[model samples]
Target: MQAAHELSQVQLLSVSIVALGFLYVSWTVTRNLLFSPLRRFPGPKIAALTRWWDIYHTVKCDKFKVIHELHRKHGPVVRVGPNHLSFSSPETFRQVYVKGCATFLKDRDFYANIQPGLGPKYSGLFNYTNHQQSIDERKLLQAKLSPSALRQYELRFLPILDTLVAIMKDKAELDLFAYFKFLMLDAIGDLAFNQSFHQLESGEEHQYVIDFNNAFTLIGLSLKDAYYGLQRVFKYAQTRVDAFLSEEKPKPGTLMEAYLENGKPKPPYTPWYIALSGHGFIVAGSESTSITLTYVVWLLIKHLDIQRRLRLELKNVPPDATGAHLASLPLLDAVIKETLRIYPPAPSAMPRVVPSRGAEMEGINYPPNVRFQLLHRILNFRLR
Candidate 1:
């Protein structure tokens, strides 16, 4: 009798726990579906109910396209998450990102998620949310990136560009993507460390380049892989820093030089920091520059008249022309701008949180503490 009573008690306890779980889920579903503050916005119900819907699309790499279509079907505002809404108007973008930029904060979960390790301290400036900190960090890099400095850097690129030309002459058809990537990586490696990655000469990606791509993955199997990848990148960067430090004569005009005072590192310019930033240049510059150049090449090829006109303008360039001189050309400048206007670096929504006391856009009152998100496709949503 005692044994039977104990068994009955165990079954009853399990039933109680399950019943409680089902009740909580029911309440959550009710609140999310009908009682949430953002319930007024139109979107697929599944999106407003759970973050999994958004995650699924993100993993599939079509969240932007899906959100664009959502706008087409549902009009301006879309409840993309239980707490997030995607705005499709350029007016909304300007109001939030331009005019109200200060009012909103970078969503740390999204921006900082890509960083290598756990920390309250930020190793990368790209994820910095504090405005003054951002400005101060830019000051460190400002001098090296100025126009005159850039002109000097342009001279360094000549040999690399020549090598690319030599390689292209032999091939009937070439992969511009791979070639441009190699060229840009070498160029940036030159600019950053006063050493080209020699990717253009080798005609293959360096180990550092491969590791960086692997490290920045936002998902799990990728995250586990990221550790090994980042370790290799840091090792590569440390090797360069070690070489620079070991030099009897410290090389002037190198990016690493700015961080050193009397051959010793400045605060936050420790060996580790320098190495991290050394790779960061490759991260920021190589991929985007290649993408932009590839787009420029494809578009110019597609439009022969524009290509001829651009070629005619280029032919007039004087020998030893600087980057500033190239910018002086009207059509080339316009082409660069128009290309960015079409395929921007961040093609879609960069999530930002609306400030306390709430915010308003497109005549809708967004309750405070919710994320004020924008759709990635602004060209189609541009306000006429």
Candidate 2:
């Protein structure tokens, strides 16, 4: 009788578990399809039910294409997730990104997975979700990156460009992308940290650079299921980088020196903070600039007539031309503008959270906490 009772208890437990599972599924379906605020927005039904739709395309690293297609199919605004909308219109873009209208905060959930294991404190400018914190952190280096300071840095670029030309002459055919990556890495290393990565000179890659690049690729893939694992790898890479940087003594006038000295008065700059900031600059600065330069070069090569015009314009300037001088060149400026329009380094959606007061765009009012993104690539492509 005791054996029979035990068996009955086990059977009852199984039935209860199955019932709970069924109820959970039913409630989710009901909420997503019939009760959710985003239900009226047009998108694939599966997307409204779960984030799996977005995750799938993200893992494929074709999220931009997928979102672009969705926008084309569903119009300017498409419900991409249960509480997420994507906008592809100039008015909405202005509403979301312009200073006066950009009341919405960055979606922390999206950035949370970006540089995982570093915590919120280490998130640099691009990934920092907290507006005030981002502002404060940016203020620290504002002077160094200002227009006047940048002109001083421009002098350093001449030798690097000369080295790049020298290197290319030796090779019958070259991968401009790789060369650009090397050039930018070395440039940022010297300009930001007063050290040269030597990638351009040595024709060898640094392990830290490689690791950070891998981390970036993983993050770009947006594999939520692999978030923890990706974070682990990123943290390990960061630890190695921090260890490397800690061995070097701070040099005068370098950003690292400023960071170390700045710690004396107020909130101390931890070693991890300094290291992470350096890593952020290396990754963000090098990658975007290299990609942009590569695209600019490619575009120029494809359009010989425009390239010839630009070359003629450059010939008219002095050999030791300054950025201000270059800025004055109309043809050069137009070519750069056209290249950037054609190939933005990061042609992806920048997600933001609706403010607590709620927000309205394109005649649709959205409640707080709804995640929406401006499709930059779509907007740029429309310009063409």
Candidate 3:
């Protein structure tokens, strides 16, 4: 009986010691997190307190809208994270994007989540380390996208546009966005790969393009507000998204296949480079064109007078005139400019890292290892 009682006593003491040790560790961790170097910067306490707080809001809110509101409330320099600032000033644009002379490196922790096994090869949008390499790759591809190329390709694209108008004219009311997406996709394929998707004629989304768009948007939203500490969780989510995207099969005669066959910089391209560059083109080209078309349609709906003016301008063009000549139409140019100003596709801020030894921005000293974001659209719009 005495032995049993003594054993129970020892067990209780051991349990108490273990509990106390855990409590000590938890308290220390909490203290370190709350009182870190970033504690002095102002932001939502929850974001600073826990990465999950930022992630929740980023994933839930219309990211662009929320960031705008935050900028308004917090002023040009808002501490978005423990070591981050969102700058909404002209100085920021020049300093970060131009004058700072630093490459706009991808936020790796954030991008890694979006860029799952996109294979070991790094795409331009997600690879900061390979900036020069990607730039070189981009230059090789640029000949195909040059102004001269666009002019030469205009004949091919014009027929597609005419086909679009013919189709749209028959409908009493159409999902203009969907139709525009088709036109853009088909046009891009023809221009870039010398083939047509005929997606509009078929009346269905290209599964590969659809998958790429879905994956990109999901990855963007998922990482928009994640703090560094919660990266593992975000990466896990990204891996699943990327896997789904990579499974998509490429269409024959598509730009992807062209890259595979014709090769970039040679007849037999590096598969990884081809994959990255091809995916990069599709992702960027499709989204921007779609957004531009959507915005124009929305603007036309809002301002019928403007739309009428545009029609008058387009109608005045000679029937035999090239699309290149149509670029001279002042109203068409104005409408495009207005639409771009109103809703820039990549209105999101460009993030830059401070110098390793710290740097001065507009006479203010920002310590090293800190991040500064240049809200390009906001700053430019505000200047106007």
Candidate 4:
């Protein structure tokens, strides 16, 4: 009986050890099965696991060149992480951008980092639910940017531009960057808020404008890193941004003010959300236009003959003539077009989530919850 008891104990010990081994084996097998496909899709192994690796490379090196090189080597589509795929082909761009058949929408992770906060739920851009929402916002804003509206804005803009030209007139070797930024600030305030930043007239920069610019750039640079659950660090950064916006009071009759007065529970937008959305439009409108002009100037500096030609075209226009007359100048317009094509302000990949039903891509089935990016720069360049 003693021998039988000892044998039974030994058998129990063996069974326990076997069970532990099976559990480990099962875990290893599951990880391999789930993660191996991503491994095969082509990217650094660390990037395949987390976006931190990709973000590190982008922050450390020339971000644009690094991403471009990755796509050039990896074909039109490459997995940047477990969930993210970067697409470079025009066909994908057309399907995603033109056809508007994107299954995935903007990642919430991207927007949750907004510092001052998101704008009105129904404001110009940020609050939209679907394509219909986007359409509605665009339609509302379209009238605001139409020829008549632009003409009105230009009346306000010309005085600001003239003030800038006066500063540049005798001031030799001006810091072109600073003056350009000031012009944009003034323009945005006048056009969007019906207030003067006075950046041009005062010949001094607005503290709020500078703070907003610095904060905005820092946020964009950190977005990818923050998206993979790095909220602790980003939230701290956002806190500083929130402080900046707090210093400036909202302008009456401006979008932020309008939302504050009319906002309620029944509408499509909230007060804070509308304020945030207004911030986006103001920043986006000013910065994008400024950057485009900057690139155009850079191009002209490289090709002095083009600069002279543009000058000649401008000189030909009568002082009393409309901005539309100059808009028809093909060469000047071409320069603008080329600059837009080359250095697209919106260069990053726009993300979309795969539908819950699952979708087939390139003859392989992508399961639900997969995220894809449509790289605008890659698509436009490849077409060239």
Candidate 5:
């Protein structure tokens, strides 16, 4: 009789487990397919049901292309995830980001997930979710990046540009992309830290640069299961950053010195904040500028007519021309505009959250907590 009772108990436990699994599936299907607010938006059925669809594309480094295809199929608005909608139109982009129709706040959870182990302490101006906080942080470094300030930094830039030109002339076959990256890295290191990585001069990658590149690769691979691995990579980066900070002293007129003079006594710009900001300056500035310059150079190389016209335009300027002087060149301006339109450095979505009061775009009202992203690459493609 006792043996029979044990068998019955086992059967009951199995039935209960199966029932729970069935209920979960049913709820998920109903919520994602029928009950969720995003159901009305058109997208792939699998994406609506699971975040794994998005994660899969992200790991493949094709998330932007996947989103572009979705927009092409689904019109201006497409539901890329169960709760995430991507907008392709400029008007909607302005509404979401510029006009602040939606929340001005960034989606912290998303940004945090992008760099898993760093947490809020490392949230620099780009990733800061709080509006006031981001504004405050931007104020700290805005002067350093302004037009006049950039002109002063250009004095530092010309030498690096000359070095690059010399290196290119010496080598018949060279990787322009890698050289541009090295040039940008050295420029940022000198301008921000008052120290140059000498990547271009050394003709080899710097340790910090290699670490940052590895950290970024790890960040891209950071999905649900890879969180611990991402954390390990970030910890390595953090150690490098700490060592850099300990060894370097702030120099006059540079970003580090400016921060020390103006931001150290402040509330948000703590020691970690300063370190993170410095890290951001190197990574964001070098990577984006290098990508943009690489694209511009490639486009110029492919179109000989445009290159000839650009050369003629540049020939008219003084040999020691300043940025302000170059700004007057119409053809040069047009080339840059066209290049940026064709190949934006930041082609992926810039995610923003809908406010508690909600927001409307293109006559459709969205509920709060809706993750809205502008498909930047699609917009650029449309422009082309």
Candidate 6:
């Protein structure tokens, strides 16, 4: 009878909690539709009520298309969430992002969600939304990715490129997607740690590479899944940093090993934070570069005349030509940029929150806590 009584009490508590949750959601939805400042913005009534509408489209893999459609239906600005508006107008983008950047900070909630449990000390450059902190972090990391630093890492890529060419020679037909992904992963690994993944030689994906991809993919669906998956990536980076730091041999000047000045880490670059930075670096670099390269290759193949022109342009670039030499190649550079414009690897919304003081854009005064997002639609040039 005591056990039965306890079970009955537990059931009652659960029912009460669910009831409270429903009440809260309903109250918020009512407030959003009837009282929110963003209610003036153009969007479907359902979207103005809650963020679930946006999440649904995100999960359905059509958020980009859907957002563009919303813009078509409701001009350049469309309300995407209760407090969020998607901006595709060039003038609005320039005003909000370019002219009023100091007032428009990166959405704090979004960056906080990506790193999960980490504090500001562990927050990487990408996650540092504060204007000053972002500037400072960029100054610190900019050295590691500068022309001179990348030139050092560029040597490591040569052997890998030769290996890639050899692999292509052996296969009459091959899926370039995996190869491109592996190639960039290997390059990023060398740039992050003092080690190459050697995936081209092994012809297999590394666990670290696989986990990084998994974590990024699942991050959108569930924060819990992202946090755990990212933990694996963080752990892998830690292991690599540990091994690299402990090596008795002469250290290579990779991002990890380069942090040492006079055999000790520089200010704000302890082993753990170095690992965190490397985690950010790997996450930021790999897949996008590979995607860009793959699309460039595919587009070139489709337009063989342009490809022939590109090949002729490349022949002029000497085998030992540095990055400066490559940068000077007009057609080569144009093709890469054109490909990126046509098929952006990350064609999603990047949201920035309006400062507490509010913002005026294109004669509209937006209240604080409003999320202003930039979409790829801005890249399209209409026949004006």
lDDT of 6 by residue, 1-384 (tens): 999999999999999999999999899888998889888889988888878898888878998878777777778778888889987778888877788777788898787755544455657656778888777766766777788887877787788888899999999987798898778778778878867788888889887777656666844557676667667878888888888877777456577654677656788778877888787777677878888889999999899999999999988878899877898899999999899888788777778988888888888889998898977645463412
Residue range 1-384, candidate 1, lDDT tens digits: 999999999999999999999999888889999899999989989988899998899878888888878878888788999889888777888888888767788777777764554455336656667767667777988888888777777777898998999999988998999999999989888777667899878878888888877676665556558778877877888888888888889546777776788887888668877776777777778888888888988888999999999999999999778788889999999898777766665564678888889987767899987876775564444533
Q: Mark the regions of model 3 whose C-alpha exceeds 4 Å error after superposition.
A: 1-37, 101-104, 113-115, 122-128, 213-269, 380-384
Largest TM-score belongs to which candidate? Answer: 1
The lDDT of model 4 is 0.63
| Selected candidate, larger lDDT, 2 vs 4 | 2
Could you tell me the lDDT of residue 284 within candidate 1? 78
lDDT of 2 by residue, 316-376 (tens): 8997778988998999888888878878887766788888888776688888889988766
In angstroms, how far off is 130's CA in candidate 2?
A: 1.9
True lDDT of residue 87, candidate 1: 81
Provide the lDDT at 220 for model 6. Answer: 50
All predictions: root-mean-square deviation over Cα?
Answer: 2.8, 3.8, 7.4, 8.0, 3.5, 3.6
lDDT of each: 0.80, 0.75, 0.62, 0.63, 0.76, 0.79
Off by over 4 Å in 5: 1-15, 114-116, 218-250, 262-268
TM-score of each: 0.89, 0.86, 0.74, 0.74, 0.87, 0.88
Between the candidate structures 1 and 4, which one is better when assessed by lDDT?
1
* Ranked candidates (TM-score, high to low): 1, 6, 5, 2, 3, 4
- Candidate 5 lDDT over residue span 162-233, tens digit each: 999999999999887799899998998777656788999999988666655555564555454354544543
Candidate 2 runs further than 4 Å off: 1-11, 100-102, 118-121, 216-253, 257-268
Clashes of 6: 0
lDDT of model 2 at residue 254?
A: 48
Score candidate 2 by TM-score against the native. 0.86
